[model samples]
Target: MLTIPSLHAALAMAVAVAMFTAFASNRFRVEIISLMTIGAIALLLYLFPLPGTNPKDGLALAFGGFGHTALITICALMVMGRGLVVTGALEPAARALGSIWRINNSLGLLVTLLLAMFASMVVNDTPVLVLLIPIMVSLAHGGAMPASKTLIPLNAAILIGGMATTIGTSTNLLVVSIAADLGMAELPIFHFTPIVLMAAVICLPYIWLVMPRLLPDNSPEAGHEPRKFIATMRVGTESSWLEQRIDEFREKLPEGFSFLREPQTLQPGQRLAAFATADDLREAGRKLGAVTAPRWLIKRLSQDSAKAGEDLVEAEMAISADSRLVGRTLQTAGIEGVAVLGVAQAPSRGFAAPREMSAEARLAEGDILLTMGRESSLQEFAQDQALLMLDGARPLPRRRKALIAVAIMGAAVLLASLGIMPIAITSLAGAVAMFVTGCVHFDKVGRALSAKVIVLVAASIAIGRLIGDSGAATWMGASLALGMQYLIPPVVLALIMLFVTLLTNFASNATAAAVGTPIAFALAEQLGLQVEPLVLAVLFGCNLCYATPIAYQTNMLIMAEGDYKFNDYMKTGIPLVVLMIVSLSVILSITYGL
Candidate 1:
């Protein structure tokens, strides 16, 4: 009843439960708890080595997570995502989504969820999330729904899509391969897709409508309304709006954007006065393929930025009362090293016509200027001109490298999805290429990684290894097999699914698949039931990795971006898990005639 090996396995399970409780309590920081978890596992394994394993071997197993391929791949994907953002490679996608969101938030979210699900069905889920995460963040900045409200749902949709096909995720492939090795017939890519599709119909409503409400609005800028500014849009010969009628261009502008004065027909060298926030103004320019500053000034800034090998940033500077540049028009202010993109006058002055402002608008005290240039230049100019520089200086997109970043990301995803190379290798190569091509600066790579995510991933890997190595996973499987003998076929199927779901939620998916597949096959033989449904149960259960961040890599990927607490996963994920389990059990029961 109580063997020495079983006791060791029991201890491992106890440690896992305690660690999870610590995380859920929220009494300690995640990093602190994660470090403690790693330390505890290492000390426990070394002090009481499992049978046939030396203490030194146990130590190696405990600390091996730091160098694991999953960790490496996650870090590389972060770097690549940073590259896409800094280079504005995904602006087009974000703009398109932002437009839809501007009309109806619910409609936009529904479209995004559907698109993410389908995209992940063909490509790997991780890459699909990688490409979409930045777009979601961009949409958040552009006044769409907060990223917190959307990222988890997006990740969930992607994971569900990955479950639909054999090649959707590595874990799926592993499950299939192991079942085939155990003498079951190999299933095709779309063999069980119909089942997952049915389940998705039941799951999508919750993800689209209720999930966002359950999540907290974690936007850092919440409660702070953005300030609007008056800007001039300069139409050059190359602008798409150059020859369009003013009314036609106005129809294309974003809602709530107002024009100071309407021109009959847009022409080269014509200046259009527009009033909107800095972000909105920039977006307007992007939509019209126009620029805000003079062509020469923009060229000089670009050339100087390239020569300095530095990315450009947009900063706000308010002119002080004693500033020497007061009373001078923007055209005559002669500010060097920065381009003035927009101006916000103090005391809520009404907008002026472009012709009047372009020719005679003077810089006055308390007027805030939105200037774009190198960060160092902005600071220096602010100090030299007696202007007060505001916080929140945003990086301007490096458009020159946008295509390069997109191509590199596309190639990596293609290689990984096609099974030509491992995701770890392809992602690592893409990260390196981003640095080499200046899509992401070497110094700014630190901003891409989160310490919380790193420690959490490391600890999860260690815990997974401990559960597998200590025979805890095996003990649990055998225990479940013993109890399932008396149950009816449908009940037995649900129990197996539930047991594997628990293991996959707490341990890694690979561990669950490896331990649960053979157990399910053997259980089927003993109980006189079809093996395919049981095996498929294990596969689906492994994907039910919704309850914990450590359950899957995509879960961890969304952790920091969503600013989610451990309890957030439990709060939102537990219900989805139960719903899917019940729905899937019934479907499997009916499909296989259990």
Candidate 2:
């Protein structure tokens, strides 16, 4: 018969509900809510210590999440993703994918979704998403889709892929391992792939077409009108532009970019002036084998600036009306500690390009100047020269280390995929290599991490621990068993999946898997039914973590980037969870003849 939960169990449930409400209300920052939950849990357990647990044990339970394997793994993966980005290791692949999206956004989205699913089946979902998230953001910035609309759907697709195989997700392995210990047959790698694939087929339409529509556009406006900077490309002997028709690259040219003079044939040492954003100019310069400015000047600045304990930064500055550098050419402007790459003469009646606007482009009032130098030096230069500094800051990509970063990433993935070592070790080793090899600067590691995500993850882990340690999870399972005893097999199976889905969405999937596996086995024994279908229900539910950010690590990883609110998860994910529960329940009933 159904019975009342113990006092500790009731308190644990109450705390979990309050935490959920706080997360959903969005009144406070995620970090604030998470830290508050941790403090409350610690204090409650200390005062009302559960059975054998002491205050010391209570403190450990509260603080243990900071050192969790899952947290470490997530942080390490983020650092490696940073290394790939700063080194420009994924630029080629991103550009290729972007070209396809430019051709047809719908087709590109479909291909990207399929690719994520397939890739995660072989490798872990976290690493796969880490690699894809930046690429997707780049595509979104390029106008394929808003990041808010794409990241959550993309993350969901990866989760579906991870559900397909035994090696797909850590929780999948945990479920399989726990089932084996409970006297169930150990499933093979592909044993459950077909079943999950079937479920995915039913859910794919919603993820691709419906989810993005439901999500609000959260992409930053800055991406659309990124600061336009003037830059001159000094064509070198190795430049592909040498003796080539300028019209051949017309389609590839960045928006608002044009030659100062329509040259029939490009020549070595020719200076090509263009108005483009920093990212566009850097990409064009790389393609043309050209330097944005003098190589010797950039190298000298790098050395001198480092000696002064400051790294060089690329910035856009505007020439004010009161500036002394009104009509002086770039060569004669004589701005020290900064290199003038290009100048976009301020538009008057029509457009006024000084007589010789190539290498000798002159600065006019209201003209934007693209310069590179130490942050402090840039500030000083702006102040002394009476220029207004722009808001955005973009670092130059480390192209020299691009190949090295790619090799390190490949090696790490290979070592882990081959079972040579655990993914945590491989990922951590890759992160260290990124720092040691200068692919990612040590100081920039902070940029890769989100303080909000770290604390939320720690809090989620602590909540999961409380649920397990206070016997709340066991109480929940027994209550579910008693309440659902009268239902038919198919309805009972659906209820079990639904229950586990709720657990996975609120608690960690790991907790759900740990708690639900044994319950499924015992309940099957009591009902005189096959254990396979019930075990499958638990496994499917563990991966149906769509309703909350804290439900899965990837969900949290995308939260800050997508600018998602708690309601976004509930709105987009709950439908998918329900669909899966219904579809999987019917599938299991037929497959096992329960």
Clashes of each: 0, 0
State which candidate has the highest TM-score. Answer: 2
Residues 1-594, candidate 2, lDDT per residue (tens digit)? 667888988898788878776765657777888899899989999999989878889889888878876567667766776777676675676666667788888788877888889767755677678778877886776778888888888999999998886667767766776677558887765677777788889989999999999999986655545556556777888876678787877677554456555667678888776666666777677677777889889889878855664446788889998898987887787777788776655665346434444547566788888788878888888999999988754576677789998888778777866668766688789889988888877877898776876786677677767876777766776677677678888898898888788877875576567567777876776677788889889988999999899788899889998999999999999999999888889888877777
- Where is model 1 poorest over a 10-residue stretch in terms of lDDT? 352-361
Indicate the residue-level lDDT of 83 in model 2.
Answer: 75
Q: Report the lDDT tens digits of candidate 1 across residue range 1-594.
A: 323447777888887777766754557877887788888888987889878988888778767767776667667777887787778776676667767877888999998898888767655677678778877886777678899999989988998898887656656665676577558886766678888889899989999999899999999954555677778888767667777787777867866567778778878777788887776788777766668888898998888988888888999999998888788887787788898888887653468432343323777788888899998899988988999998858888898899998899789877876668866688899999999999988888898776766776677667666766677756665566667767777677677778888877776665566557766766776667788998888888888888788778788889998899877787788888887888888888888777
Candidate 2's C-alpha lDDT?
Answer: 0.78
Q: Global lDDT of each model?
A: 0.78, 0.78
List where candidate 1 sits over 4 angstroms from the true fold: 1-7, 101-106, 119-198, 209-225, 320-327, 348-360, 487-575, 585-594
TM-score, every prediction? 0.77, 0.79
Give candidate 2 regions above 4 Å deviation. Answer: 115-198, 209-230, 252-256, 301-312, 349-359, 485-497, 500-575, 582-594
Clashing pairs in 1: none
In model 2, which residue pairs have backbone atoms overlapping below 3 Å? none
